[model samples]
Target: MARRGKKKGRPVSGWVVLDKPVGMGSTEAVAKVKWLFNAEKAGHAGTLDPLASGMLPIALGEATKTVPYVQDGAKIYRFTVAWGEERSTDDLEGQATKNSDKRPARAEVEALLPAYTGVIMQTPPQFSAIKIAGERAYDLARGGAVVDIPAREVEIGRLEIVEHSPERTLFEIECGKGTYVRSLARDMGRDLGCFGHVADLRRMEVDPFTADDFVTIAELETARFGEAGRGKPSSDGQAPQEEIRLPDRFEDIDALLVDTVVALDCLPQVSVSDDTASRIRLGNSVVIRGRDAPVEAEEACATARGRLVAIGAIEQGMFKPKRVFGG
Candidate 1:
């Protein structure tokens, strides 16, 4: 018998800003989008918890190469913290382990915000995805083991209370990578003497992608189906309710795809010539001679004819290709 090769899907490429629905895990959502696009490859920039919903940047095919750029960008989250109850999972997903009778006043809560702002140390929730000794901390916690996750420093660019009520307080935070909103709620409750857990969470922005760029799964499905005309009529002579249509060609799904270069928008750009692009594609560094080249930057995106060629550093008037695109 001969070995068989794995089946490959279409070579669909680009980013899809999915407005993930609550209760769907990040992996599940990625799989759904991958299937909907029938893409050969797929990945996501950031992992959003099942309880939280909002902008999830999904990269298909070549766009997967730009995931790290988007992941490293700043993130904004709006969450609600319910006072008086602490859950094992740090959110509404786990059992309540503690309670409190005290609710901090609006002024009091505002006063404590400064202490958590800027750079601060935070301990991740025990029931989290953090790995411990080759095992996930959450797995150990679920098995009746006391998981002690280490505290690490995270940057909070901005933190403010969006709303405050007697039972819960809504807050919005802009933070750098690795900052956990659930942990923020947990620590705030501890600081106020009213143990708390996240009641609800929604990510509003992830770097280049904002609320405006988000596309609901329903909308994506409708667009895919509407373009593919895969909807079939039922016995009632009405078309069956279609969740999404699977496109047969990559061009058919162009409306939903975002250019790969959009992920590198934060970096400085250097315009190169066609010859320079060819050299970069061949893993060669080219001397910066164009007028559009950035004067100075730690890293930059090189484009030729308005197409992303590479992302690399410029040294001594030379553009080096750390990662080449469209190769």
Candidate 2:
């Protein structure tokens, strides 16, 4: 048998809530963060378009297993709609497909908010990643094929105007997963008799994560170099002698990581003893003790001494381990 080479990168694990910059796709962002941390594995909780900027929670190593929780969570976005022209892609990146001279008034725009809230059927933008018979919709759209994508149900928790003018309208919305801000602008424009498209968009929150958890790429770069890269100004106002120092150790930058269990904030959690945790790690079902413990849970996590032990289900007072974690 041939000897397999050891996997590259360290087994560093945790979440890196990135304040993703515009013009960088989600895949690229994940790759960059993975390289920066030299993690064994990496993934992102949700996809953020290259044109949009804001909170992008990235998972490394064992944290990747918890991505589904974050992806399924509610999202809040602030976007601007530029009136007059509707683009093929429904954003600034595409060519104009429809034009309108009429612009909606502030009151008229506000009036439309009530109709958009709650559960609504929305057709996703043509230039989206949605699959059509194993082919990506964006690929088909790029090839000049206009697909008749069906409208699907999406929940909008809140929709309110942040600012409004005759030429443009800014709105903030809290919506469920699979909701597209571009589609929202396009549909609203059609209803108001003034064709419009997304001019700028920024995601402000994603479930457990908010702007408070954001760490920018620039900040990451600075953290990588450490204080050795900083130079103190000379008192004489001239120049200070250069002091060269070796770069900080790898562990220095790991401080920015949010605990892997943070992603499970929305799920039910159970605390287990060390012996029980060991059993869970071996893929065994253990009886959950305590009167306050949940009788059953479709999705839950078990922790041992504050560390994640497993993610699985609780049924009939028993916790069955599905995905176990390492120390």
Best candidate, TM-score-wise?
A: 2
Listed in order, each prediction's TM-score against the native is 0.90, 0.92
Question: Which tens-of-lDDT digit does each residue in 109-166 have in candidate 1?
Answer: 8999999899999998888889999999889998999988899999999999999997
lDDT for model 2, please: 0.88
Model 2 lDDT tens row, 87-113: 999999999999999999999999999
True lDDT of residue 4, candidate 1: 91
* lDDT at residue 230 of model 2 (Cα atoms): 49
Each candidate's root-mean-square deviation in Å? Answer: 4.3, 5.8
